[model samples]
Target: MLHHLSIRNIVLIEALDLDFAPGLGVLTGETGAGKSILLDALGLILGMRADSGLVRAGEAAASVTASFEMGALAPDVAETLTDAGVEVEPGEPLIIRRQLKADGGSKAYINDAPVGVALLRELAPFLVEIHGQHDDRGLVNPRGHRALLDRYARVDSTAIEAAWKKWRLAEERLERQRAIIAKAAEDRDLLIAHLEELVALAPQPGEEEELAGERATMQKGERLAGDLSSVQQVFIGSDSPLAELRVAARRLDRIAGEHPLLEEVLAALDRAMIEADDAEDKLNRALDALAFDPLALDRVETRLFELRAAARKHACAVEDLPQKAADMRIALNAIEGGEAEVAALEQAAAEAGRVWRALAEAARAARTEAAGRLDAAVKGELAPLKLDAARFRTAVTPLEQGQWGAGGMDRVEFMIATNPGADFAPLAKIASGGELSRFILALKVALAEEGGAATMIFDEIDRGVGGAVAQAIGERLARLAGVGGGANGGQLLAVTHSPQVAARGTQHYFIAKSSDGIVTRTGVVQLDGAGRQEEIARMLSGAEITPEARAQADRLLEGV
Candidate 1:
């Protein structure tokens, strides 16, 4: 419930602080006494669009703060706040603040943490629901009718929603498979031809680099064979160095005993002769192994060209061709698997559809049955509000397949006939302003415990009706406020002029405007015992409080 509201520097309200209790709180004042300003300030806290005109004349900004006690909040309220990252401390107040600057900019806060205006708007529905002459969003909107009926009937539509999601998922998978199969069919012949080409070529892994290396070696051999033969000639053929060195070493060996220097020279020459023979043998081996084949080179080059061309055609590296072939084979395999997979998915989808239909049909039946009871209950409330001839009915019509939703396959609307023999139409269109208020009151009383919002604010809902009708509205509002009814219930705040209505409030606030020499301001006073009697008397009579009016006020209080 709304625990407190504080307004500063708003239009006609320089400063005000209000502490609210959990029951009917009536704000009564004369016409143009700034009763609407209070509601406007409250609207600002609820994340309504801000206007610079709301600021006070001398101030640069206006601010409104609303605090709520959420210890006994509805489950939806707790879930919404938790999802939004707004922590609701147990046994503490949740505060929302809005500030409107004179420069046409605004800011919002939740528990003093800055947040966007959207979050505040999202959080508002769980805290308060305001109904005025033209506000029909909660109880009267046709789009909300089905859900309200379900809430009234205590029907859980979770199973139907879950089934619908499963059916949708199955349908999505089936469609995806069908699309894949269509694409595979379009590309089938091309894939098969490519596969056949790859299989015939039979390119081995790393074969491209191997062929290039072998080709390089063959080209180098063509240049090296003549060079190796010339080296053989120098070492052992035609040059005659080894023969001359052998003769020189034998002459030195014969003279080594005669001269020690001759012996050292002979040893060196012997070592040189041995190295020359080993070099000649290596040259002979090179000459034997340096043969190059032109046909082999041509074959290697041709194979390399084929592999490079295939790589370009496939838009991949030469080494990646094998993996590409494997991928295509997998794609071909999927084409074969698609038919069976699609059939299975279709079966699953059919089963999901059957489950959803069963759940939705049960939900529809529950709504139809609840609608009858709801219409009867609302009709029973209408006569006492002075609409005895008016007929109210909850219309539950089956929706088209295309329009069916997770909610159900039904479109629920509240229809009414304002007069006898009149065709039933939308309740909003048929009811006059006064008739609409009574109808909404009756509906609210019927759905007292359904909506999750803890506080309901009515901006003069009892307007233009007086006597027993006004008294009836007052009683219903009190009942909604849970006055003398229960320990824990919703709160009702009504801005009213009816003395009966004002007198019936568990708490009373009087809004009035006062002017100093230069400026005007609005203030509210929580009326006490004598103050309450005097204010009710003032509401009964004109500017003066007459004895008769005071007596009438006493009677109204006594009746309450």
Candidate 2:
């Protein structure tokens, strides 16, 4: 509830401060006594557009501050503050201030901490609701009808939103999978052809390096083969070194028995012959190893070329050919198996959609039922506010599938038919300025307990009606403020001209304009019992408040 309001340099309100209380608080004055200036000052703190003209003449700037005691902050308000890093403890007062410069610049603050005007505007709905003949927000706007209906129905959209997200995610996955499969199908034939080429070549890891090594060895052997053959021939013929060594050894053995020195010479000759025979055997083995087939070298070269050419075609290193072939085979397999996966995904997406639809339909049903209750409650209030012939309705119409959203598949709007035979129309379009304010009041009275601002200010709601009609508006306002054991007690401030409505206020304020010849100023004073009586008498008797008017004011107060 609003606790206090401070204004400075705003139009005629050069400097003013007023403490507000709970229940119905009425502000009354003569028509040109500057009641609207007070409202405009309050609007500044509520984040309404600022006008440089609002700054007092010759004043540099204007500012307004409002203090509200937040017993339990609304969820949206708490979330907004938390997101903006503004900490407010439970039971703390939320202080909002707005400053307007004469140059059309402005700044906003929350609890003395700097903030954006947008943030103030966002928090305004929870802090207070201002209803006037020209108001297009709150109950009058069609865009907020769905949310208001949901609040009224106590509909929890958590499950609905969750289901929607899951369904959308599933649909996205299905689309992605379809694209993948389509692209893979487009390349299916090319993939098969590449796989075939790789399979035919059958390139092994390190095969390119091995073949190159073998080719180099074969080329070297070709250069040395003739020379090696000549050496082997020398080792094989009868006049070779091994044969000559054997003849020497035999001659030495014949003379070894005749003399001791001759025996020693024969032993040395035997060792030499053994060593010479081993050398000749090694030479023959060397010649056999050098004799490689020329056709084998051609085969090695052809294999190396084939592997390299395949590597260039696939844009990969020669050693990567085996892995590349394996990947291509996997691609082919995916293309062949894609239909099964696609069918499974389609089933999943369909299931998700079904779940979302079920939740949305349930919410829609709840809103439809709630709309009936809301319509009846509002209609019950119409007659009291002098709208007996007018009919109110909560229109819950089905939305097209393409327009369905997280909230549900229904569009909710408050409709009214001003006459018995008239067609129902949108609340804003069908009502006059006075009728619109009355209709809004009726709606507020009906939805008071659902989700309304902690404080509501009605600007001249009792206008153009008096006597029993004005009294009815006053009684309803009192009930809305929780006066006399009424439910949904909060705070309500009304700017009114009716003495009956003024008499209903638990608290009263009088607004007046005074001129000091050169300067004029507007001021507000909280009224005492005598003060209230005098003000109400002035309202009843116009310029001359008579003794009977005061007596009638006493009766009105007594009735309240």
Candidate 3:
């Protein structure tokens, strides 16, 4: 519920502050008494587009702030606030502020945190609904009509959600099939080219790495072979010096005991012979390692070249060639899978089409039933508003396939006939300003709880209406505030000029203009008992309030 509103530097309003309460609070004033300005201030905070022209003549900026107590907010609102990282204390006011600068830019804030204009717009429907002759032309909007039908039909949200789920499931299956179909339609030339490359390469996982290792070995083989042969000749080759060392060591071993000094020399010679023998054994191993046939080297080189050529052809590294081959295989497989997927998706799409048709039929049927009741209810209100001769009807038209959308396959619009002989036409095309207001009132009364918002505002709801019709409007507005026998159980604020409308309010405020010639300003004054009577009387008798009008105002307010 909106708890407080503050305006600063707006056109004709230098500064203003207003505190609103539950039930219906009416703002009453004469023509050009700044009543509309007060509502405009409220609209600014509700995310309406800001114009620099709205700023006071001498001010650099204009701002409006609206405070709402969201302690008992709807679940969606709570989640929204939670996601925004704003704490909503049980009794705390959620303050929204919008400011426009003379520099032609505007800013908005929620709970004192700067926010984008998008968020402010998103929050608008949840906070208030301002209905006036010119502003609330939405009563005739086809989408609004469809929404009302759904609301009055008592269509369970769960059922609608389930229907959407069914539609989505079918849609998903169809999309999957379409993607498959597209894949299968690829030119055969492309597939053949890809397949031929993979087949020619005949690559396997890890093959490139193996060939690389073999190629490296072949590249270094020439130098290694020479080194190994030289080493082997020195140690283990039959015509090598190592053989002479062995014979020398044997002679030394045999003569070691001939002399004491010769013993040390013989022992050293024997050790040398042993070391030389070990070196010969190692050289034999080296000779074996370098003993590759020419054909083997040729084969390794050929395989490495093949692998390198394939890598170049595929634009990949030697090691990545194998993986690329696998990828190609997958693409080829997709060529086959595409046809099968297309069939599946085609079936799914057909099923989705069937499901949507059935659900839409059911929704349309529900709307048809609801439309009759809706038309009857609104028509009932017309007589009291002095439109007994008027005819009201609801028109529902189904889509011709191309018009399918998230909403459904049908369009609903409220049609009206102002006179008995006239055929019912779109309300917007036929109804006068006053008629539109009353029609909206009837709809609001019928669908009060259907919308998810926790608050409602009716700006000048009683405009271009007076007498008993004005009384009916007041009664309905009061009903919205739970002032009538039935409890709408939401806070409502109305700006009005009708005495009956003003009398229906649990809270009343008088908005008037105050000027010092050089400076004109707007002010809102909360009225007490006598003040309220005077205002209501003024509404009834204009600037020259008469005794009879005052008496009538007192009686009207007393009844309320």
Q: Which 10 successive residues of model 1 have the least lDDT summed?
A: 230-239
lDDT (0 to 1) per candidate: 0.85, 0.89, 0.76
Off by over 4 Å in 1: 72-92, 195-327, 486-488
Clashing pairs in 2: none
Stretches off by above 4 angstroms in model 2 are 188-340
Report the Cα lDDT for candidate 1.
0.85
- Candidate 3 has a TM-score of 0.78
Q: Report the C-alpha lDDT of model 3 over 169-240, residue by residue, as the tens digit.
A: 777866765665466446446756855776786767778678667656655666588777776678655656
Query: Native-vs-model 2 lDDT?
Result: 0.89
TM-score of each: 0.79, 0.74, 0.78
Better of 1 and 3 by TM-score: 1
Model 3 worst lDDT window (10 residues): 180-189
Lowest lDDT block of 10, candidate 2:
283-292
Off by over 4 Å in 3: 71-93, 136-138, 161-165, 171-175, 178-355
Residue-wise lDDT of candidate 2 within 1-560, one digit each (tens)? 89999999999998999999889999998889899998888888878888899999999998999999998887878999989878889989999999999988999988888888888878888888988879888889898888888888888877888888899899999998888878878998998999999999999989999999989888888999888877776566689766777778788777789999998888888777677678778876765665578899999999999999999999999999999999888777778897898899999999999999998888889999999999999989999889999999999999999988787788989999999899999988999888999998888779875676889999999889999999999998998899998877889999999999999999999999999999998999999999999999999998998999999999999999
lDDT of 3: 0.76
